[model samples]
Each structure stands twice: as structure tokens, then as C-alpha cells.
Target: MAESADASGGGENKSVHVCVAFNVSNSKMPAFCEAACKLLAHAKADKGCRRFDFQREVNWLRSVSNEEHSLFMVRQGWDTADAVEAHVKSPHAQRFDGTLVSESMLVCAPSLSLFGSAMTTSDLAAIAAEARATQGSEAAEPAGTSSRPVSAARSNGSRPSS
Candidate 1:
């Protein structure tokens, strides 16, 4: 999974949060982990990377119930979307393709997702307040109006002072 600022409009800064999962059979776990470690080392060395970490599920019962194969999760944070794009095209990332497909490894193709959202604090407080107010209510707020303060600042073309 990757989340970043929207690229559609002007003055929008782009950043990314990415997580990828790889499934490997128990027998191939060691090899897969070694390859992942090598990849992580290179990724961490990249200037645009803010974070790069890997984790293996340790609960056998949960793994058996959800997936028979071992699961490894790679989490990463990039300073910008361009950084992520560059990393994907880097030679180190390219090498992983061969390692993942090697005869001794049972790693499956990784699952990935990317999301983009506008980065702004606008209306957050109002939304949070409304959520708190409606914690146990079943009714939804009306279309044009909000739960009190929602539109107060936006209507004035200014953000509420933090």
C-alpha cells in the first residue's frame, strides 16, 4: 500500500507511505528473508527514503488461519512521489526481480496498492467534533448543513486558528 498527496492540482506536495507483502513457503522463508534484507539495505541507503523496515509474522496460528504461507511485510515512507518512482526504477530494485524468481525461493509476486489524498488540516477539527458528537447516534448529518462548526471557517475562506 502507498499513500501520497494528490498530483492533480497546483501547490500540492507529494509524499508516499508504502507497504508490500510477500508470501513464501516455510521452506523458502530463509532465502526470501535474505533477499529482502539485501533489498532493505539498498532502499535505506536511498536519500529520499524516510523509513524502510521489514517484519515477519510470528504467530503460527494466525498465519495458518489467514494464509498457509509465511508472510513478510515491507513498510516504507518516501519524501516524495518522485523518490518512490526513482526507487522502483533503480538497479537495486531491478535485481530483486531475479532473486524473487530464483529456483530456491517460493516468494509470490508482491501485493501493492497506492492511494493519494490532499494534504490539508481543513475541517479536521469539525469532522472530529462531529464524530464525537455522533458516536452512538444512528442519524446522519443533513446534506446542506453540518453539525454546528463544520462550515463556519470554510464559509469565511479562512481556517480556524489552531
Candidate 2:
């Protein structure tokens, strides 16, 4: 991936890091995950998207194991604010506006924040590099219980190591 900031100047307000938390109702788990996966897949291809990933919280107890909630981090390199607005308006996002949620479902806007020096392209790369370096050989392990090793090149290029 190319590391270039869309910022016109060295101004501090160039880009933003958006972390959205979804408090999904327990009953809405499947639909939310499906729609979320579709949105992330599309957003990953968006021009303004520097990096994007979704994280699900671990449920220690079986009682809360089914609790549905997640965090989506979309790092908008230079056009953070505008990109977020456009994301909400984009077809990939609008599709889930109403259809993804049932009457009992609830939703909330992501708490937006700016990451001055931290929002730069270099910062993102360093973070990714650190993760990849930590994972090392473990990242090559087979998916699930299969002993088959994942393709070395494919795993390296897929995304920053978990």
C-alpha cells in the first residue's frame, strides 16, 4: 500500500481517526455481522479509507457469549471528516441504514475525534509494522485446527497482523 497523505499542507487539522462502537442488541447479532462485513469489505476499497478493521469483544461467560457489540476503526488519512460523511451517504452504508435493523434494534453515531500527529500515514504504517513484527511466524499458522499452513505471501499482504 502506498503511504501518502492527502493533506494539502502540514496543517494539524488534516485527517482524523474514527472509532465507532456499535452496541448491538443480543438478538441482532447475525444481521449486524452480515451487514457490517459487507460495509467493511466495501469501505476497504474506498479511496479515502487509509485503513479499516472491525473488532468483536470476547465474551468470557456463556451468558454474555452471544452479546452482540463491536468496534469499527476507520482511519481517514487526510479527508477524515468528509470521508466519514460520505461513508454514511455511500451506497455501501445507506444500504444498512434501515434494512439491517429491526424495530427492536438500536443504533448510535460514532464518537468522532481528531488525532493530530497520530493521524498521519507514517503513524499508521508504524502501527501496522509493529503488529506484523510481533506476530512473526504465528501468523502463518493454519486457519482453525487444520495443519495446512497459510500461504506466506498471502498472509503478509492480507492485512496488518492481528
Candidate 3:
């Protein structure tokens, strides 16, 4: 999964995080990646964008029938929720949406989520607690049996053993 975090200090400043995952058929993977790269470039150039990243999931068990297509993740951070809204309304985003709707692209519907800080202190505390609990569970798992899935590639061009 692609992950990005943006933090801004000041009582008036708030950060927004957006994450999206897409599945593209093997035949259309190349075109999808090319288009996605262009879209990301445009987003990164936007004044509102603070951070942007893309990642392709590597399926070690490709011989199995679990997945027929490749998964791509897009992670982004914006200065505020309004910035994210403006990005969605941008021309580049409109064109990218059109690409997603094209039949020849062979891309499945994407899963998307947007996150922003909670208004109340109690709500923020609850969210933080839940995140910590999730992390603890993953740390408790045996090596190779982690609840959190790991990407296939390492920075050094090596794959972790399954």
C-alpha cells in the first residue's frame, strides 16, 4: 500500500489525507501506469498538494488464482480538506476520471478514503487509540505471519521470503 502523511502546525491549519487503490488487468497495466504517472505529476505540481506517492503491489503468489489483476495505490496529502476538494474539481482530475470510465482500460472500480482531523478532542483520542491497538496487534504477529501485508520489493531490490 502507498502511505503518505502530512502535518501542519498552527490552530487554523489542518491536513487532509487521501488514499485510493485500483486494480488493472494484466493487459492494461502498462497504459494504466503511464496515465497514472501523468496524473500524479500534475497533482504534485498543484500548489495545494503537500505530498503524493504511487505504488504497485507485487503478488508473490501469482501462480495462484487469488488475483487476476495488479493493484496500484495512490496516496496523497493536502494542506486542507478544501484543497482536496479543489483537486477533485481540477481539469486533470476530470480527465483521469474519464480514463477510469473507459471500457478498454480494464480497470476495476477503485476503493477510496479521505481522512481529516476530528473536531472534538475525544474523537481524536479514540482514533489515536485505535491506531495504536492495530499497530500492537501487527507487532505481536510471528515473523512471516504478520497481519499487515508487506510489499514484495525492498529498497535493495530483494524480496522478503513468504
Give RMSD to native, each candidate: 12.3, 15.3, 10.8
The superposed Cα distance between candidate 3 and the true structure at residue 11, in angstroms, equals: 8.5
Candidates sorted by TM-score, best first: 3, 1, 2
lDDT of each: 0.63, 0.55, 0.68
Model 2 per-residue lDDT tens digits across residues 53-147:
77655645432123344433434443555665677688987876565544334334444444433445776677678768757655666648445
lDDT of 1 by residue, 1-162 (tens): 223334321234465767776666667667777777788889999878988898776776435213446666678877777788888888888787577876445434566644343334554565566678785352465565545445343341111122
Residue lDDT tens for model 3, 1-162: 112232322224477778787766777767787788889889998877998898777657542113456667788888777788788888998888788677466444576776654346766676688889988988888878876666785352212123
Instruction: List candidate 3 stretches off by more than 4 Å.
Output: 1-13, 60-67, 117-162
Native-referenced Cα lDDT, model 2: 0.55
Give the best candidate by lDDT: 3
Where model 1 places Cα greater than 4 Å from the true spot, the runs are 1-13, 60-68, 104-107, 116-162
Q: What is the TM-score of each candidate against the true structure?
A: 0.60, 0.49, 0.60
